[model samples]
Target: MSLALNIHSQRFQLIATAVAASLVTAGALAAYNSVSKRERRRNLSEEVLRSVSNEASVHTLPDYSVYKEDASNVRYDEELIREQLARNYAFFGEEGMAKIRGGSVVVVGCGGVGSWAAVMLVRSGISKIRLVDFDQVTLSSLNRHASATLNDVGTPKVKCLERNLKQIAKWIDVDCRAEIWRKEEGGDLLEGVDWVIDAIDNISTKVDLLKYCHDHNLKVFSSMGASAKSDPTRIQISDISHTIYDPLARSVRRRLRLLGVTSGIPVVYSTEVPGDVKLLPLPEEEFQKGPVKELGFFDDFRVRILPVIGPLPSIFGLNIATYILCELAGKPILNPLPIKNRKKLYERLLRDLLHRESKLTGETINKLPIDEDDVGMIFEDVYLGRSVIPPHLVPSRPALTRWILTQPLTPENCVVMEYADAEKHVKECSNPTIHPRDIWGEDVNALVERRSEEVARQRAPA
Candidate 1:
C-alpha cells in the first residue's frame, strides 16, 4: 500500500512539473510575440515618417524605363551587367532605383576621375545630373577621361557628359555649367540636389566646393589625385583627413585644418604619392636651379607613360562609384564617411606578439620603432579628447610597416604562433569599427565655399 501511494505521489509531482513548464513557455512565447509586434509597428511608423519627410514625395514615383532602350543600345556586356547588378543590389534596390530616377547630382568636374564617376552614376540609374566644368575637352584629357571622344574634342566637358548621361537615361534632367564653381554667385546648384560628386583638378577650386557642400549639408564625395600611381589595390575610400602621404590629401587636409574644421566630406584618395617626373613651367630661374619645384597638386595627378592604358584608374574610379551608390541608397558601404584606421590596437597587438615571441625564443626583446609623434598622439587622442589623426596624414606603409615589424615575428609573417591573416591582424587591433558612411554634417559652410566660382549648374524644378 505504501509503495502504491509513493508511485501515485511521484506521478502527481511529474504532472505538476510538466504543467508548470508548459505555462512558463507559453508566457515567454506571448511576451516575445508582443515585443516583436511592437518592434514591427515602430519600424513601420519610422519608414512612413521617412517617406513623408523626403522632399521628393512618396506619391510621385519616377520612370525607370526612360533610358532602358538607350542602355541596351550601348551594347554593354550582358554577363558583366548581371554580375555588377547582383553584387550591388544592396545599393540599387527598387526604392534606390526610384531615388536614382527622381534625384539629381551636381558633378563639380568633368575631367579624368569626374568623367568616369559621372558615367558610373548615370549607368547605375541616376537619371538627373548637372555636369559642371569650365574647360573644353582636350586631347590630352581624353587619354584617361571617360566622357571625352574624338567628336567631343572641342565641346565643353559638361556638355559632352550631359549628352552621354542623357543617352543612358533619356529623361534624366541635365544641367551643363561651362565654368568653375564659385561661392559669391549664390546659386542653387546644391539646392534640391540629392548629392555632389567632386572630380575637379585644381586644389583651391576643390577646397571651395567642399566648403560649399559642407555648409549646405549636402552629401559630397571627392576624388583626390589619381594620377601617377600604378597600384590599383592601394586606391581606397578614406576620409580626406585620414589619407596619408599623398600630396593631394595633404593639401586637402591643410586647407581643412586652416578652416578649423574637425572633419566632414568623404573622399577617395591614395596613400601612394606620385613618383613621376613632370615638366614644370616654373619661373625660368627656378626651373634651371633644380627639377622645377615639384608642383604639389600638379605632381599628385601626373602619371607615368605606361605600355598600356591600365585598369588602375578605372578600377579605383569604380570603387569610388560603389561608395557613392552606397551613399545615395542610404545604405553606406563604409561609414563615418571615410574609414579611419585603428593604429592603437595595431600597436598593442604588435607589442604583445613581440613580447610573447621573445619569451618563447629566449632572445632579447627588440624594440619596434614607434613614431614618438604617432604613438603618443594616437594614444592621447583616443584616451583624452585630443584630435584624431588628421585624415590626410593617416599612417600607411613604411610608417605602418615600421610599426608592425616592431613586434617580434618568428621569421615567418605569423603573429607569434597565431594564424592571423592580414584581415585578422586588422580586426584584432581595431577599436569599435563604425560605418564610415554616416559622417554627414548639418553645417555645410564648414567644409565648402559657396559662389567662389562665377559659373555653377542650375537645374529646373521638377
Candidate 2:
C-alpha cells in the first residue's frame, strides 16, 4: 500500500510540473508576439518616412508643445447646435451627436473637395475647423469650386470657404490660413485637430503630408484626382491600397508602398473611365488670371491643365465628409472591402441610394437577352432602385394593390414596383385593370442565384 501511494504522489507532481512548463512557454510566446507587432508597425512607419524624406526636408514643422491646450478656450453653443442637429439624432443618438459637435477638423487645400467637405463638417455640428490653402479663387475655379462665385474672384479660397462655412452654422468657429502649407513649414496646423482632411492636388506635397500624418498617428483622409472624370456613378471611398484607375491614387499608393506603407489610409477616388478627356492648355487670357497659373510650377506642369468637370469633385468631397461622419456615428459605411476585391464599388453606392421603395415595376427589369457589355444601355439608377430595362420590351403597370410587398428582391438588380404605378399608365387604358403576371421561366431564378453567388464570392474579404 505504501509503494502504491508513493507512485500516485509522484504522478501528481509530474502533472503539475508539466502544466508549469506549458504556462511558461505560452507566456513567453505572448510577450514575443506583442513586441513583434509593435516592431512591425514601427518599421512600417519609418519606411514611409524615408520614402518622403526629400519632400519633408523642405520645411521643419513648428513645435506643437505650446498649443495643445489652446482648444480648451474655444467657445461653442452646444445646446443650440444639438437642437439643430436633431436629424442626426437618429444616426448617432444624443451622446454621439455631442461627440461630433465637439469634434474639430483641419482641411488642407481649399479647392473643390476641400471647400465642400468643410461646409459638410460644419453643418454636421463640428464646432471648430481650420481651412488652409494658398490658392485664390479665379475665373476657372468658378466652374468647379462650390463656395466661390464671380464676385469672389481673386480672393483667397480658405477665407471664402470659411465665410461660407460660418454662414450656415453661425456658432461654428472657422480659422482661415491662406498661405501654402509647405512641406518644410510648421505643422502648427494640425495642433488640437481631431481629423486632417487632405485635399491636396500635388503628389509630392501629398506624400509629405501623409508621411507626417502616419508618423504622428493622426486620423487623415485624402482626396485623389477629381479632374477629368465624367461619370457621376463611379465615385467610391476606399483605402489607399484598394484604389484603381485614378492616377493620383496610383501615384500616392506607389510612393507610400515604397516607404513601407501598404495600407491604413482611406481615399476618395473614381474608377470610371474618363470619357472623351483632352488636356487643354489654359486659354492665354485665362492663364494670366487663372488661380492654377499663379503657382510657379504651372509654367511647365501639364497634368494640372487637365479638364475640370462641374460636380465630380464636389461628389468626392461630399463622399469623404459622409464617410467620416457616418463612421463616427457608427453607421454602416459601404465597406471598401468590395473595392479591394475588384468588385463594383460605386454601383453598390448607387444601389444603396436607390433603395427607397422595396418592389420595382416589372417593366423596370424587363426579362430579356442581355450581354454584359450592354449593361450601360440597359441599366440606370432611378428614384426607385436601379432598373434593368430592355429597350425592346414595353412596360405594363398593374392596379394598386393597397399593400407593400414584404419579400426582399435581388439587391444587385432591383427596382421598385410602386402600389400607385397605375396612375402613370392612365394614357394606355380607359379602365384600370390588372393583367396576368408573366412568368419569368426556370432560367430566371437560376440566373439571379448564379449572379448573386458570383457577387458573394467577389465580396468576401481576402
Candidate with best lDDT:
2
C-alpha RMSD for every candidate: 22.3, 25.0
Q: Candidate 2 on 217-237: residue-level lDDT in tens?
A: 988999987777788777888
- Score candidate 2 by TM-score against the native: 0.54
Candidate 2 wrong stretches, greater than 4 Å? 1-79, 282-304, 330-334, 340-462
Q: Mark the 10 consecutive residues where model 2 has the least summed lDDT.
A: 376-385
- Provide TM-scores for the models: 0.52, 0.54
lDDT of 1 by residue, 1-462 (tens): 454535358788898889999999999999999999999999999989998999786777544453366653554454444444553455477676556556678878777777787888777766577877887886766677786788999889888888777665444567888887887762456667778888776666677778877777888888876766777656778766566545566556667666764367777876554553444344455445333212243421122222113355565567667777766776777554333444454466456555544544468768643332233222222112121122223223212111133333321122111222323433343333421111222232121122111001100000
Residue ranges of candidate 1 with Cα displaced over 4 Å: 1-91, 276-311, 335-462
